[model samples]
Target: MFLEREEYAILRSHVHADSVDLVDALAATGLRWSEMAALPPRDLTLHGSRPMLRVQRAWKRIDGGKALGAPKTKRSRRTLVLSPYLVQPFKRNCAGKQPNDFVFTAPEGGAWDSGGFYHAWTRAVSTMRVGRPRSPPRPVTASPNDRVSTTSVTRPQSHDLSHTHASWLIAKKVPLPGIQARLGHESITTTVDRYGHPLAMLDDEIIEAIEWSMNPMAA
Candidate 1:
């Protein structure tokens, strides 16, 4: 379905098992299409108590094809931790593969290409009847935006998992500097640019704590 959060949840609740895996990897990891496609098997590692992806090289666009390149930005070359939910599927898929093997490969053992992935994704989304386009928000953008129409809302690219993860971290009040490192941003600024401060979920907590400390009588 289109990239809207509600639509995504709905789709997740009902999509086929294979499609669900694809969606989970995309939405939870926030990896770009190419990065996801080019993920090497060796990137998967065991973290504190979970599996993590050691991001290093990324796939770059080349002469009418794709080639290996440095990570997206200097900051993008870092490790990414994943929950057991994610690691289980990975282990199952990686059964006998070598470390140099692509993390997500085609049946022929070739690397994943976004073009093919997109085609498959679109078909899956369509089958699920998710994020169908409707009347445009504005007349001007309607034509371009409604390129794909269904009965529900529009779907977004899977890379939005990065934003989702960032938002979740912010909402949980996770430490900022740590997040910056996890996402491999050159600077916290880069992370902030892509993921703005989480909506102020801490206002009540901060206010209550201040009030309690100020009024000894309440304590």
Candidate 2:
């Protein structure tokens, strides 16, 4: 369900101009939907040696309206490195905004609701035609006697972009601990449990490593 680069590009091209920055930031940093919606201007640090985003609060849906509160977990309150692609967009989004202003806001300059964001996402994705099947990848099969292990691979909703981000990192061979830190997972086990599938293209390398370990003198 993760978007290929071309798919991502197509989707981005179709997103409303005002929302492009917000969507890019979500894909780039894997921020939770709520966290992204509640992001404040003061949380952005673009001039330091390393640009970063401090995830602090999230928009919560209460009885009759939305409310702001601390992130769902203590570990979720962390800083994420900002990719170069995200820097200018974020800067533009913050221009002339007060410190308390949400970095990404609705057309009326208010916290975005899940429904509104989903509608926009649906519109953008509807126009996309360059990617693989949008359904989740099939589970890798093991021996008949072994218990089936399924990895999280679906992007059924926009929120699944977080899983896509983690999958991309895992495919790049980034360590689980590092991915956990970046995604703000409470534990490394959670990161691994959800994204531990070895990418199909990496199978050769995995086999070679195993062979080398078992027969170091053969070559």
By lDDT, who's the top model here? 2
> What overall lDDT, based on C-alpha atoms, would model 2 receive against the true structure?
0.79
The prediction achieving the highest TM-score against the true structure is 2
Give Cα distance to truth, residue 119, candidate 1, Å.
Answer: 1.6
Candidate 1 stretches greater than 4 Å from native: 1-7, 13-16, 46-48, 107-109, 127-153, 209-219
Model 2 per-residue lDDT tens digits across residues 1-219: 566566677777989987788888888898999899999999999987799899999877789888999998999999988877788989988899999998888876677778888988888867765444333434577455765435433234676678778777777877778888888899888876776563554678779989989996958
Per-residue lDDT of 211 in model 2: 94
- In model 2, the runs with Cα more than 4 Å from the true position are 130-156, 198-202, 213-219
Put down candidate 1 lDDT per residue, 109-186, tens digits, no spaces.
577667766666666556665544664445565665456433456664456556666667767777778778876777
Task: Count the clashes in each prediction.
Answer: 12, 0
Q: What is the Cα-based TM-score of model 1? A: 0.74
What are the RMSD figures for all models against the true structure?
5.3, 6.5
